[model samples]
Target: MKKDIEIPKVEDISVAVVKEWNDEKTEEVFNVYLINLQNKQIQNTLVTSKGYGENQSTGEKINTSVLRHFIGDLDAKDFAKIEPIIEEVFGLNNEYWVSFFQNNQMYDKKFIFLPETICDENMINVPLLNKKGVVI
Candidate 1:
């Protein structure tokens, strides 16, 4: 008898958070990366990101910073990175929204950085969404 096997799904794109440091390692900057993991290129890509947090006294969300980019084409297995202002997106209560288009299809993904994830690691891998609203 043959046993059934499960195949894992592969993602075409990925988003990640990285830290850039100066020579002394004391100065650092936070960055976001959009990577194309597929074999083919993605065309007419646009990326917009925003960071927000809930108010301490009011329970209302507030915007911290906004970032946007447009790329004609992103080559296969390549990536684009944006370095946001460190103070805008580094707070413990902050969350981010990253939206982009690949091959004319839109993908929007939200990421929340837990204290442990960013504090202990130099790089943190975030999630990406596909056209069907599925995490890729």
Candidate 2:
């Protein structure tokens, strides 16, 4: 009989450049933050835009948007705690996605639990799977 395996919660956070036009004329910037649900601590990350486009008004200039990526580990409980805050900050229609790891590969799947509740330090070095089965 297959036993029910419990999956720990985890969240991966990232910030992408949403807009970029005419590098010389205007530059877009993105600020990414990671909030600790338990303590409400926040970490700020900044990303500059980069892209290639023509600035017709300026005659000659390149337009670009630079995307920045940030990944944070949070357990299920903690994630739930701050889900509302995250949603409010990022809002709807943003480019945000979650992934799961299996056999050394990341799979696109929404985790059911908050990432802050999981114990990251203990599982950092451990492989996603082992001889028995998947490790949460």
Structure candidate 1, residue pairs in collision: none
- Candidate 1 lDDT, tens digit per residue, 17-118? 655565688987555566777887777666666655665678787775556677557788787764453544455443445455565565555555543345
Model 1: how far residue 105 lies from native, Å: 5.1
Off by over 4 Å in 1: 1-10, 22-26, 57-60, 85-88, 92-117, 121-136
Q: How far off is residue 130 in model 1, in Å?
A: 25
Query: Pairing residues by index, what is the TM-score of model 1?
Result: 0.58
CA RMSD, predictions in order: 9.7, 17.5
Put down candidate 2 lDDT per residue, 1-27, tens digits, no spaces. Answer: 246754544433322122222347475
Q: Ten residues in a row with the worst lDDT in model 2?
A: 126-135
Candidate 2 to truth, TM: 0.21
Q: What would the C-alpha RMSD of candidate 2 be, to one decimal place?
A: 17.5
lDDT of each: 0.55, 0.29
